[model samples]
Target: MNVKGIHHLSAMTGGITVNYQFYTEVLGMRLIKKTVNQDDTSVYHLFYGDERGNAGTELTFFDFPGIRQNQKGVSSISGTSLHVRNDAALAYWIERFTEHDVTHSPVIPYAGRNVIFFEDPEGQELALVSDETNSGVPGGTPWEHSPVPAQYGIIGLGPVKLTVRKPESTLAALRLMGFTEKSRIPALVAGQEDIIIMQVAEGGSGGEVQVEPRDDLAIARLGKGGVHHVAFRIEDEEELLAWIEVLNREGLQNSGFVDRYYFRSLYFREPNGILFELATDGPGFDTDEPFETLGESLALPRFLEHQRESIEDHLRPLVTKRD
Candidate 1:
């Protein structure tokens, strides 16, 4: 029972309109799904990535207007890595960011590859890596509003580096979740400079889990632009159940199965307070919309049928068209 690659990464955002513009217009990803946060109706939950909001191509957000900013520290998520096609494309992104006047750090090396680090309007750390081998995604998608082009954009996932307070307990829990310790290596990342620890499975991509030794478990306070949760892919319902059993046997607390529109999810916070979700891959984004017209409209799960009108009423009006 091993885990697969990343399905998507979700974050909290404050500005809805700017967040929409930056992800779609500037970043070049398809706005696959548009809806309000199920828990918080006032905020919008925006999804951006390759066409169809496919796995590894998604970077999701929950927009909270007028919220305070968060501080960058040991317990916080280091950053989210987006894989680009080549060094030339990486350079293109650098120029694009410059053209937009988005303040970014100079190019730095990370994970044995050169990378450029920057933050979004909300201070969520994001980076781009130039490693063709890491992500075999072609950089060209013909979708009208495809991000980075289907081919050159994030085809698959890289690794999500973390700074945990307790490595042993964290490692033990991950191992129970089917993660195996692979190796320790040198990192090319600029911000989290000290340790480069890694572990992974065959179907999934692994990132460095760097532990910054501390006194106790860190309580993460979410503000404007911070990662809300990191989700891992499960092949199907069977895999999801297996993990549920594993977690229960190990005495880990988890948010029992919740049926999301596109996928079924189970939530659990790791020892370090970073929320982790295990999501099923079947009955995917295409379940509601056809492959041809994905992201054409707002789709919701059948269970939320009664709330459809209310949900639609609360969402901000937006449209996606070919430029």
Candidate 2:
């Protein structure tokens, strides 16, 4: 199966405002869209990324207004590393974090790249890394609201980092999806050797890592403050279908195809228990809004038509026309 790259990453959160401030004001991503969660209208489904909010550029969050912040452990998502242009950008981000008083660790190497690690207000881990490997595919077409200049904006998502209870089951599923053993590194923090790294050879999206849980033996499971799923990108429907066949042969559960407005998605779970999605790149974010205004307002795929009004009501106003 020919998998293009990462599509988008989704995580759960506690509030809409904190997400808006962290993703935009702190990280400098453009607030491309302000919409509500299609599944639950009361919460917002916010997307922050480059001007165009391209596939890999996306970091989406679902806000559950009063939910308690969840623990970050073996069964939770570890972190997401975003690819940037160089150390200059990385340094700029370090200073940016300092200016906001957001605590973060110094740069460290992992999977053959230098990365700056930090946490969102709700404790979701995120990283910014220089594109030293130059592996990311070209970012999608430009959009107006992006904060970084179009050229230096993200090319695509570097690999995602996942921590699971047992690595074997997830490793089996990743192999079936064509991910290969890249290398094994010492745990990024310290006093740990339970880390394993994997890469998608054909993917232009960057790299992904899966780690063994620090204290137990089970797949990382999703919950209130956990990552909802990780989406991998494919060139088109045919390539997507081929992978569906590979997944079935491996006995993994997969939902054939579902239209998600801009792109068609195939959903499944990896062996270590993380939700995985395979999404097509077409009918992209540019489909609903013109390339000129891709992230300007609420955009609901046709399937969620009836809930639009309520979705709008619950979201705290973000990038307004004036700003």
Candidate 3:
């Protein structure tokens, strides 16, 4: 079975308040889930997405109290993208970013699409891509009450950018996973000159990965403003099970059949040390919380429910409610 497009991206953040304000108010995505990191149980794991917290729309973050800023280099998820419906949406964002005093670049072309690359307050690399011509995998619905108008709101995730040491090694692993080499183009990404490699499934932006090969940089140091992992969409649990075997058959050592509560997952690392996960799309954020009151309170997986009090003990309060 083949995989779908992007599922969600988990990243690191140093502070919760500023990060929350930037994503919910500035970016205008809904805070769909307020939870603690299952692995650590001490830090906040916040999820921002479209109104319903759809699979392809989640951009999640894990909070670490005093982490260092990310050292930009090879072997990192260099950039994350958000999909907007058209050129007019991009224009609206340019104005909004300016009004908010957000640091952003003018619109530029790369790998057959026009995107406006920008950075969050903590130096998280982000792009707003124009989906005017996208016909591959579709984007999700925008939050109706988003500070940014619904018509120009950030819909779903776009292509994820991976910075690796060897292009061939990363590309080889991708081919085995069903991604096709769509196009390769050169562009200045975050002030560095490198080749932007596009690996995609036909014309779907969510199914795309922009891989940059750089021989002149050091391995990235993970901290605040760094991507922890990028998960690809597996249409169902059955396909995810098949992917477990596929990854093993390809000689890749992976975490086989992990039940993430919301979805099942399989985790592995490609040749370049970038973490990748194959995840099922259903049993989503709505599973534990009702649609109307999503993100209004802290949510925990059933497995973590018994320790909710202890987990809540370590959490620092940052009000997650919005208008």
- Which candidate leads the pack in lDDT? 3
- Judged by TM-score relative to the true structure, which candidate is superior, 1 or 3? 3
Give the candidate order by descending TM-score. 3, 2, 1
Tell me the tens digit of each residue's lDDT in model 3 across 146-182.
8889889988999998888787788887777778877
Candidate 1 local lDDT, residue 41: 62
TM per prediction: 0.86, 0.87, 0.96
Return the number of clashes found in candidate 1.
Answer: 16
For model 1, where is the 10-residue window of minimal lDDT? Answer: 203-212
Query: How many angstroms is residue 232 displaced in model 3 relative to the true structure, after the best TM-score fit?
Result: 0.2
Error of 1 at 108 (Å): 2.3
Clashing pairs in 3: none
Error of 1 at 16 (Å): 1.1
Instruction: Pick out the ten consecutive residues of candidate 2 with the lowest summed lDDT.
Output: 215-224
- Top TM-score model: 3
How far in Å is the alpha carbon of 76 misplaced in model 1? 3.0
Q: What tens-digit string does per-residue lDDT give for candidate 1 at 101-151? A: 876876676656677888787787788777644432233232454545544
lDDT of 3 at 302: 97
Q: Once superposed on the true structure, which residue ranges of model 2 sit more than 4 Å away at CA? A: 136-155, 188-193, 202-205, 213-225, 313-319
